[model samples]
Target: MLYKELVELYKRLEKTTLKTLKTKFVSDFLKSVEKPELLEVIPYLILGKVFPDWDERELGIGEKLLIKAVSMATGINSEEIENSVRDTGDLGESIALALNKRKQKSFFSQPLTIERVYNTLVKIAEASGAGSQDRKLKYLANLFMDASPDEGKYLARTVLGIMRTGVAEGLLRDALADAFKVRVELVERAYMLTSDFGFVAKVAKLEGDEGLAKVKIQVGKPIKPMLAQMAANVREALVEMGGEAEFEIKYDGARVQVHKNGNKVLIYSRRLENVTKSIPEVVERVKEALKPEKVIVEGELVAVEETGRPRPFQYVLRRFRRKYNIEEMIEKIPLELNLFDILYVDGQNMIDTPFMERRKVLESVVNSNEWIKSAENLITKSPEEAEAFYHKALDLGHEGLMAKRLDSTYEPGNRGKKWLKIKPTMENLDLVVLGAEWGEGRRSGVLSSFLLGAYDPVKGDFVPVGKVGSGFTDEDLVEFTKMLKPLIKKEHGKEVELEPKVVIEVAYQEIQKSPKYESGFALRFPRYIALREDKGPEDADTVQRLAELYQFQERLKGGR
Candidate 1:
């Protein structure tokens, strides 16, 4: 198929704010492609990439490099391109505008094909070291020289990983379902297992529902970790779980998915990014603790001090950033692997198994020690017992407790009521930081108020929920200013717009309906809880979830 076809769809997608319309545009385009191989490539291109997040492949092309490539292609100076970027606040638009000024088109330039663009981008990402920069620049310039002005805009945006097409994973899942006449849940399940939409699309198109059913958990591929909903209290949690549940201590640390195949071990973070090379101690500990030849386990890695007491959560993050003298850092800040659940074992997928059965299987395989052990848990049918365990966890410097239903199966990537978390403080929502306002008075020169947003699955965008200016220490204000500076997209007066990369956990006194925010609901007296470095913008709380919580609060008030 011609690359211009896809570019036209992107143009339509950019014009519409409704997600259903966007999905229709994508599904129609997918249906038009007759080739199976092209079907596999289209999903990646729409997502602004050739590989999945877990593949660890990057284009390594910075903004300056992109400016140089655009200049070379359009016969424009770098200064002209840079000035246009400043005026437009977008590099892709600047490139498109620069290319549109050309008087004549190349007579020898051929029509760009889908395969040509995908292959060229892959080659650019694979380029490395020495003179690879020049090679990449040449490839990008050649492609731009052949592309139309409209096509060049999306091409540059895709290469820069900022397509801003408003097409998210949820929309793509629905589109695949519509195009292939399959169930959305089936597509979602396949996506959760493989973490590759391209592969899922190919299978759904070729093999249909049966092929999606065959998708199982693999040892090497990381499955999306199952998430939990928040419970108001121990009594509510017990009642919701049918008066019986397994209560486990909630540790404040990094969530890791460990995959073991004989001597090889790989660790993935909650965002599915590989971090095996950063934690050698974790690899060794998993190898020694589990006796199975092949398995996939989920757990938390908490840093501890010399006395074996758990350290602050931030201390554990230092390990992820270490590239030199890793062994020395490992010794200085040792980590304890607290095993919670198992997903796969011995070539058999355990996600279909019941929680209690999986727990028994996990307990049998792990040889618990000081450094590697199961999470402290208690099986209780009484709310009093669950309450006691919750306090005990807090006394031990842990977060709170997680109450899981015994009959519940592991539902990958679904945040249902099967598992619920109860903390001592008010309820918290994981929100995306959209922008910030500059501080005033003693807090001048730094950002003091943070504009928060929640994910709207229907719109495939972050909707503004509220702003937060409290619950941050002076130290936090200074650190956050440094952290958010690089993400600044445009500044207007004291308000700075951000790229929506940072996720923060926020606590609120109540949820109120308001027309002032786009989400139609806002958090009353919202305050910053902590920076959730472990999560991404996609993992933030959804608008639907917030509405559900508001309804639950109303029911509580009526019952009282």
Candidate 2:
């Protein structure tokens, strides 16, 4: 197949913001492809990649390198390309413009094939040390020289790893289901377990539902962690959990998934990034605490003070960011592993197992130690007991309590009423950062005052909430600037438009009715709690949820 075909499909998908049209375009394109190998490769191409998320391979091309490559391909100077990029606020558009102005072409150039393009990009990513940057630039320039203006635009964007085509995972799942005539649930389950949609698409295309059913939880593969909904109070949590629930202390630490295969142990973060290198101490302790030769358990890794009390969440996060003198960092900030749920053990997939059974299995396998122990939990039918647990957790410098139904299954990536979190003060909402304003004074050059939004399922778009300029430290502002730089879409004086991708936990005092925001509601005194790296924009709180919270707040005020 021609790479131009895929480029045309991307153009079609970009023309419409309607999700159904986009999904249909993808489904139609997938259905037209006949080769099983190509079927496997198409999903990755649609996602603007040739490697899986867990592969740890990057294109390693920076903006400066991309500018140089485009300059070489089109014979345009680097300054001209840079100026165009600045004017358009997009590298892809700038590349396209430059390619259109090319005066000469190779005497013998082949039309870029999909296979050739994918292979070339893979070679670019696999390029390593010692003049690899020059080699990568050569490959990119050759591809651009052969590509048309539209193709060059996509090629540059894909190489930079910032394809803002708005094609998310949900759309891919729907497209796969429609193309293969399989159930969306099966595709989602396979994806959640494998974390590879390309594999899921190939299996479903070749063997259909039976192949999807054969996909099982593996020891090394990181499964998506189960998420929780928020509850108004302990009574509501207990009521939602069918009266009898297990209340566990919610620790304010990083969520980790530990996989033990024989003597080797690996730890994955909630975002499924391998943290086995960062938290070696936790891995060693997990191996010592769990008796199973092969097992997968989920827990929280907390940094503790010298007196064994938990440190702040921000302090614990420094361990993840540390790249040098890891042993010294570990000794300075020791970590504790608090096991809560087990998903696999000894060749058995335990995701379908009940919460009570999973908890029992986790307890039986884990030997209590000072650095590694099970979560402090209690089975309670009374809301008072749960409330007491919540307070006890807070008094211990932890988050609140998580109330989970005893009979609930461990549904990966699902945030439902089966598990609910109850915390003190106002409830927190996971919102998406839509845009941000340029800072002034001390933060003059950095992006600050984020424009927040909530998901609107009905419109399949993000509805604006309000802007927040509080709860961020100097370090946070710097980190956020680095993170949001690549996502900037357009600059409009003080505020810059962005692709809504970053999810953040925002704490607000109350919800209020407002016509100022597009969501028809605004948060009162909204403040950023933390960046929720585990979640995507798709997992953000819905506008309906905001309305419900507003109504609940009104009721509470009336009762008071």
Candidate 3:
């Protein structure tokens, strides 16, 4: 397809705020994609590329590169190309314009199918990591040649990993369903259950819409988060919900959904990204304990202390980030899998069931281990009880609690009043200062926002939880950046990792289950709370602890 096709779709998507239309537009484009060349670049561009690291000046420079490319091909001035591509932030469009100007005709003429798309992605993934820079560049260049003008545009943006698709995941799900002439809900279930587009296409083809509807978490499939609801303290959420509402303890561990079939374990995140290989310990534990051939459960993956208390989020994260010598890390960290709720068990779909019902099933069916256990449960009648529990949790050194309505059904991906979170002490934590960017507007010279993260057990690394730019004066910001510059380990696009030494307290509005962050949790409105000068990285909180906090709040809201 020509880049013009995608541009037309993007324009249409922007014009309509209607959920159905927005989804349809994406599905239409996905179906319309025809370039075999685009497949090589699209996945890397959309899923692998990182943009959060670019400075304003670097971003401007990247844009200038595109403008130059466009100007070289077209008679238009560089400024005009830059201006045209500004709102879209897509360099591919400039390329498409230049091509169109040169060709004087449309270049895209075929329908893009799922199989062709996947084939291209597989090639790209295969070539990644070990491929030389020139080889990668050639691979990219070839994709452009093969892509139609519209495909070229999207492919270009994809290569840059700048997917400004107006359509979100939910909208895309809806669009895919409509495009295939199936119910939106059914399509969603299929995607959630399998976390594989290949399965989705097969289901669409084999069972039609009904086949998709039948897609429940089975031996190999698991449901994904449809929406993530996060909050600060219960009081704030209560106000957001227009007075009293149930709440749950938001745990401080990795947010994971586990699927078991007999002895096999497959783990996925709220984002539906496959993470089975990342957290092998959790998988082994689930395999030993659950032993179910077809079951899917959602819970926290945390690290524990010698005293059996939860460790910092970083401990569990380290296991996930490292590839070599994982056996030792697994034993050292010893990840615990906390099973909270069941999405599917046996042949039944529990997502439509109430929280209490699901919990009952979860408790009755699954046995907890030292590493993989059930979250604590509590019942609260009034705000006072909730408050009391919240304090109790804090006294136990937990982040907070999650409150959930007993009657609420699992609404995947939607953050509603159904679940609420409460945290203790708006205070300090031993968090890693991931990167520093120039402050915008008034905060110009000094670092205003600092990206923060707790550790992931599986990766043995720090993934973003939130950014902290507050709590620092100009002098502190300048000193902090200068002090931490030498700690830089490596640069991946816009993100810079230094030795995980600079620990800071991040004041966030609330804790949320996130797919964007690799560790599976995010802080709402996270700002720099304070710098912990006296702590080491080892003293930082772990993923397990966060999971415990989230789960604790959940029990309270469930009236456990």
Q: What is the C-alpha lDDT of each candidate?
A: 0.87, 0.86, 0.59
- Cα lDDT tens digits, model 2, 339-456, are 9999999999899999999999999999999999999999999877778788889999998888899999999988778988787765789899999999999999899899999988
Clashes of each: 0, 0, 91
Query: Candidate 2: global Cα-lDDT?
Result: 0.86
TM-score of each: 0.89, 0.91, 0.58
Segments in model 3 whose C-alpha atoms lie over 4 Å from true places = 1-118, 127-153, 174-212, 226-250, 312-319, 323-334, 379-390, 405-408, 425-468, 471-526, 529-560
Candidate 1's C-alpha lDDT?
Answer: 0.87
Give the range of the ten consecutive residues with the poorest summed lDDT in model 2: 551-560
Select the stronger candidate by TM-score from 1 and 2.
2
Q: With candidate 3 superimposed using the best TM-score fit, by how many Å does residue 71's alpha carbon deviate from the native?
A: 19
Worst 10-residue lDDT window for candidate 3 reads 50-59
The order of the candidates by TM-score, greatest first, is: 2, 1, 3
Considering lDDT, where higher is better, how would the candidates rank from best to worst? 1, 2, 3
Task: Tell me the tens digit of each residue's lDDT in model 3 across 497-544.
Answer: 555557876666656799988768877776664555423343466676
TM-score: which is higher, 1 or 3?
A: 1
TM-score, cand. 2: 0.91
